[model samples]
Target: MAVHLSEPDRLLPVPGVRLCAVAAGIRYKDRNDLVLMELAPGSECAAVFTRNAFCAAPVHVARDHLAREAPRYLLINAGNANAGTGQPGMHAALACCAAVAEVGHTRPERVLPFSTGVIGEPLPVERITDVLPAAIQGLNPQGWMAAMRAIMTTDTVGKGISEQVALSGGTVTLTGIAKGSGMVHPDMATMLAYVASDARVESGLLQAMLGRCADQSFNVITVDGDTSTNDACVLAATGASGVAVESTEDRDAFEAALLRVCRYLAQAIVRDGEGATKFVTVRVTGARDAREARVVGMTVAQSPLVKTALFASDPNWGRILAAVGRAGLPELDVDAVTIHLGDVRIVVDGGRAPEYTEQAGQRVMDQAEIMMTIDLGGRGHDQAEVYTCDFSYDYVRINAEYRS
Candidate 1:
């Protein structure tokens, strides 16, 4: 399959990181379904995952392992979700981690496992274990697109991004690949993302920066408001560039480059959301913090009523108002809220703008991309942005036959 290549402005490999993929055939009848990435032993890693109460076995396992001081590898499969399978599900994940550990010559606890596609099924770790030796043998650094296609299930396209960071002595590279187009929400999405960088960063610093980057990147998208069982994003620093990142200046530069790659991939995921024809950006300003602003924006952006109206170009701002009311924030003034659809004014003072016309609003909504801005004219001042798309018939059509 021909994958969508990332634009030149975003095309670059992670410095010092070599990657390769082999067809483990864990669930699919053919094609590669497993990905193994080996990192330098002292590399630092940071991750964020789904908050789903029934998070998959791997999500649970990876969360605990991320607390470790360092990591050496990541193993991901795109077939069985390995979710809601109870205790044995975890055992299966551990076994797979152990297998990869053996191959990487690292402890099982140093490897992280991630799974996506389908729910409530036992993960056949043996399928991955059986072919892991081949994956290990096939490991290289150039097959970025190949690794991307190997991790897709319902996704129709592959998502990847890269960026470069200039260090005092040398340049560092960052690259990431993601697979997710449905069952997206946050506290985390159903997505599985692997990012690698050549800059040597401390574990604590990487974790701190990842948390901040995720708030603005991966956490900024939603497809169905359904968090997945195996959502995760990891950055494995290879120290290949020989840039010793010790001070805050180096950390800041590394985090910025990492965020650049992750943010682009996150947008790509939204653009490729299941059945999405229009990509929308919801920008909420004058809130109280990123948390409140994003909450309000996601509530509005993810509303089926609002999204369907957008799909049909209906220009229904009332749905936006309804969503803001239920966003579970501190006291909000209905009289102080104003919303704009692109450049078209829709709501003013929390009510329909006197100059509002459905025609103008609809015209703006019909565009392939639209922006919704919410302003709170009070001391509640903050901002956040979320990416979403209009819900369409194709979305239902694609997901309905997903597992059939």
Candidate 2:
């Protein structure tokens, strides 16, 4: 039910990466639900995971494995989020890694596991292990799109992107895939994002760059204001193109390319949010600091009244004003606040604009895409933007029967 999104036209694969997807029949019947990705040896990896106190077992294992060594394989399964199972869940996830390592002929410490879908249910380990050989046998260098689809749980469309740019040494390729819809909010990362590049980047630099990129991209989007227990974003550098990013210019180019892929994937998640009909962007400017600006934007974006008003095209600017006022800004001056809905200034100097009319506001809200800006009129260059989707009736319906 996304407003303006469809299956990607094409998703080119990155060098030094091979992937395959299979129907493990873990929870879904006759559908591809498991994905396995193999990375070239010596590829550097960096990742950020959810801050949820009750994170899944795979997240725990993946964190530990990533710390121990460079990962060789990424194993993901949909339809059963191995969460809330305590010690048994951890063991089950480890078993999955063992199976993947045994079949791929690699050390178990080098395999990372990920899971999504229904929570609190035991993972069907045997079903997943039984199909490991088939998945490995079907590995293809051009399996990016298939893997994208296989990781989807509530996502309506598979999301992916591929881009190339000429750096100092040569042309580097960046390819990324993401899956998310519902239970999305920014803490560390929004949902599952895996982006790989064909450039040589040192381990420390890769980790720092991925963290900064994620803060600007995945960490700024929200849907339903619910942070999932399995959110993660990973970046891998294969060093396959022989393009070692060693200079400031090369780093800038590589960072720009990575940002493009991350932004595309992050926005796609909002566009395809559960039962979403309209995409909304909230911009806050003139704040004292970036954190405050983001707090204001997210507060407005997460307001249920604001989202429902957007869905109905009601042009109820009061809900937006109320949310901003309650953003916990201790130094905010009400007299200096201004609000705009897609250039239609609704509030001026903390009150309704004299030139504003109901018809004008209604026209702006009727569009499928909207931009709402809040200016605090402070003497600072700080600003932030948060992407979200309008809440709709079908959102309730989807969750009401999610497991049925």
Candidate 3:
């Protein structure tokens, strides 16, 4: 079950974006497994892909296409990752892109392809190509929800958000969708996500804004400590609103709204993590730098012992303490460190607090959401937070029988 997460009641559409989904028998037969998103002419796009050395073939194709021209369409399909197939996989991805380009009346370089699902399998190129004409004909501005659902694999609930930010000239709309349950970790970006806005922003500025937003959002989340081979996040600005984000105030407002949308989607992924019962937040403060804080937080968040303890509703402070100690911070002072579970201080001066009790800790652990704070006792003023989930019996079962 998803932890305090639900499908979006409504998704406001961006004016210059049109989307639709078609039933492509690529992997799933009964539902739409392919989605197409069309951007208005002259739209600017920024994307960040998985950094894994063995990334999916679509990742390579998408990167090359985005570099060559302004994207006109984004083709996405679920249930086949198209990774590890080497040259054959690349050929298949290109073939699908070419088909979309031919049908959409655009150059092949104007189409970016993205895929996610079981790795090491050939993408059913014909299955996706056969639906290209249907997908294009069905494109509508209000197809955000359908597009969100079509890109899902193991995700139990659809994740999406819409926000309208008022600028000096006018208001701009931002809508985003994401999909992932497990194999989520920060490597440039965690999962498959797409955010679109009608505001006017250049590609260079949009890329910089996305990088910052991603650092504070997707780059701070982890699930099972595994990054997907097909992880990709895209931010598109259609310039349909005619409100330029050139002024300093306008730029700040746009980026802030973008960050909020990104953060919400990132947390939703953790809340809907596979078999997750608790949404856990690990905050590391007082570190030498922001990077150090994030490293320490992820160390604790990815610890199996700590995650299992969370699943069992066990307040195992020692497990958290051990993970932090091994985080390899330079010249760390154990005696100066402090830790807390919610508002209950569990560790003081690097040991169990005198006022702490098992009952108080258990009370916090029993909740569906938890916050763990570790104060590194450093003089520097840097902090970072990582979002994760507890590991349960179903997590193992889901992955063990995933292929079956």
Candidate 4:
């Protein structure tokens, strides 16, 4: 396999994070599909995962591992999502983690495993185990690009984002990488994301913060409105910064920066979605509260009619209204609605804005990035935003024969 990189391939160094990428070839023919991210000892962790009742074995196993030990390394593979394969799947996932722990000289509980692709088939632990030594030897700061690329399946580009934040001990850096393209939605975490930071944060608090941040970030984005069985997002801190940040100001700054990195990569994931052409940003306002607005916003963004029109570049506003009416917001006042495609302003106060013109709507739809805003007309106190992408026939083609 050729090294096809993405816009997020730029190299970055976060103080405590070390990455290694090697070809395990779990399902892919030649390229590296397994990545090992080794975080320094004393590193804290946070995670969010899919709410899908039938989630993969590794998803549950990793959560249990994090509960038992502070994370030291993460083992991930693509092209073989370990989902729906019964008892054997659990054993294989545990074995993969054990192999990594053996190499790191850490307990198996200190390692987490993640897998993606072809549900129901057994994940070949031997593939990763055979390559573990070389994978470890390949470890370094320079492998960020390769590590990010290794996690992709249908994603045309690798997604990574980095930033630094100030804390009580000082300023520490955060780095993150993620992958998702087709089976995307906003329940728990809809895809895979791995993040590490150098700051000292408590695992309990960091997990809580990560859940909240993703609820507003990953949980709001939709690609085809389908949730994946392999969705996993984890945050690990190496405590290399020597700063214990507990103050509200310090925590908020760190949280904000973490959110920034996650959001950037999440958007990039959607942008590189299989067969994706246009990136869509949906913003909803005027609901009674943020929750209500988010429900309505995601409902609109996930509508097939809405996305299909996007693929065709057809300027359709009625589809948007139809989605909102059924959004389950309880007595949603249709009369108090307004919508806009970017700045074109299509609907005004429940009806087509008098100035609505096909030419203007066409201009708005033509942009590479499309923004659709809705005003429920309540107050500024309530608002929600989501990100998604246009659906095309290529999306169908890619997933139809995905494992074949």
Measured with C-alpha atoms, the lDDT of residue 394 in candidate 4 is: 84
Candidate 2 lDDT, tens digit per residue, 1-404?
Answer: 77788878888778888999999998888789999999999899999999999999999999999999999999999988898889999999999999999999999999999988888899999999999999999998899999999989889999999999899899989999999988989964337889998799999999989988888988999888888888888899999888998899999989988989998999999999888999999999999889989999999998999999999999999999999999999978887899999989998788899999999999999999999999988837899999999999988898898961
Residue clash pairs of candidate 4: 43-237, 81-116, 81-117
The C-alpha RMSD of each candidate to the native structure, in angstroms, is 2.5, 1.1, 0.9, 2.5
lDDT of 1 by residue, 1-404 (tens): 11233333333666555566777666687688888887766677888888778888998889888776466778888888888899999999999989988887888989888888888877887778998888888877776777888898877777887777787867878888898888888777879888888788777777788889888889889988888877888877877778877777777787778788778888878788888888889999988777888888899889999999888988888888898888887677888888899998888876999999989997898788888998876536789899898789988998888861
Better of 1 and 4 by TM-score: 4
**Greater-TM-score candidate between 3 and 4:** 3
lDDT of each: 0.81, 0.91, 0.93, 0.83
lDDT digits (tens) for residues 42-161 of candidate 4: 778888888899999998899899888778888889889989988999999999988998888989998888988888898888988999999888878767778888988877777887
Give the runs in model 1 whose Cα sits over 4 Å from its true position: 1-11, 328-331
Cα error of candidate 3 at position 252, Å = 0.5
Model 3 lDDT at residue 276: 97
| Ranking of all predicted structures according to TM-score, beginning with the best and ending with the worst | 3, 2, 4, 1
What TM value does model 2 have? 0.98
After TM-score superposition, the amount by which residue 234's alpha carbon in candidate 1 deviates from its true location, in angstroms, is 0.6
Ranking by lDDT: 3, 2, 4, 1
Q: lDDT (0-100) at residue 334 of candidate 3?
A: 94
